[model samples]
Target chain A: MKLVIAVVQDKDSNRLLNALVEKDFRATKLASTGGFLKAGNTTFLIGVEDAKIPHLLEIIKQNCESRDQLVAPVSPLGGSADSYVPYPVEVQVGGATVFVLPVEQFVQY
Target chain B: MKLVIAVVQDKDSNRLLNALVEKDFRATKLASTGGFLKAGNTTFLIGVEDAKIPHLLEIIKQNCESRDQLVAPVSPLGGSADSYVPYPVEVQVGGATVFVLPVEQFVQY
Candidate 1:
């Protein structure tokens, strides 16, 4: 058994989850903040057979496609201050890594 | 000097993010699977001052309200094989714990 951990952006989470459900795979979600942009993100923990790692990774890849997001500089008011500029950033916000850890035991009741 | 971690249902994530943005606070979201039903969830990590902890908790409480979600037993095939029941579970999918860690160094560049 292996543990698959993936961190994804908030936008693509629902679709990614529904797809996982359709595949009958179960995962645990954890809330974690980012060190760079300090934006909200979702982390998924999945337990699967080692043989299925590639297949599961494909699913994650298909779900975590990158896109452009408009981010404004941090300011007290709505970037309404003198430094307010709606800059379009092509953020590669997708699956950071799939941590596959060997599980010593697996049981469900 | 605290690390507040919150795990919330996926359904309520967008609204929560918006609210946090409105409050001018940034959080990190992680995607993780669950131990119970193996469902999808969104986790948020926020670093805040002790005095702001209560205020942040209130936002989470207001958003992470209990709700019913239908889950089926895991099977190679859908529960449609033999049994299928749309069960209602009042899952308390909210902030599990807040880990406040004292940061030895804090810097922003």
Candidate 2:
């Protein structure tokens, strides 16, 4: 068995879960937060047979999507109106940031 | 040091983090999944002084406001075109689901 950990944007959790359940796959959901951006995120624990990797990917591909967000640059120039310029930065956020690792053992009792 | 774990919607992660940084708090972000909803969620580990609970809560209250979301009831009626009820159920999603636990030991070297 393999445990797949996927970190995705919160906006897509509902659709993602529904799709998983539809496929008869079970996951353990832990409420989580992101350290980098301090945003709300969901960390999932999924145990499945090695052969099911493709299925998991299919579901992730369908639900977890990436997108862009606008954020202000951390180091904004400090100046009066005459010298100030808004430092607007765009960043890509979302989609699946997943980690697949070998599990030594998995037991549910 | 206390480990404050907050599970929140992905939509609010960025804002939430910004608020924390603004307050000089540092957190660890982990990607997670929900067992019930099978959706995407973020788990955060925030270390703070015990006295900072109220401040943490204030930030959560500001960014993790709950909202209604529409989900389909699991037991969808069969019968193709005739026996059908969309069965749209509105559920509340979002807000901080936090767990504050005492750490037996903490070390950073």
Please tell me which predicted candidate would have the highest TM-score against the true structure: 1
State each model's CA lDDT, in order.
Answer: 0.63, 0.69
* Model number with the top DockQ: 1
lDDT of 2 by residue, A33-66 (tens): 7742335777666666799989898898778767
Which 10 consecutive positions of candidate 2 chain B have the poorest summed lDDT? B32-41
On residues B34-104, what C-alpha lDDT tens digit does candidate 1 reach at each position? Answer: 63242356666776766776677767767765545455445535446556434543433433322333445
TM-score of chain B of 1: 0.65
Regions of model 1 farther than 4 Å from truth: A36-38, A69-91, B1-109
TM-score of chain B of each: 0.65, 0.70
> Evaluated with lDDT, which candidate comes out highest?
2
Distance (Å) between predicted and true CA of A62, model 2? 1.7
How far residue A94's Cα lies from its native spot in candidate 2, in Å, is 2.2
lDDT of 1 by residue, A62-85 (tens): 997665555544544744466554
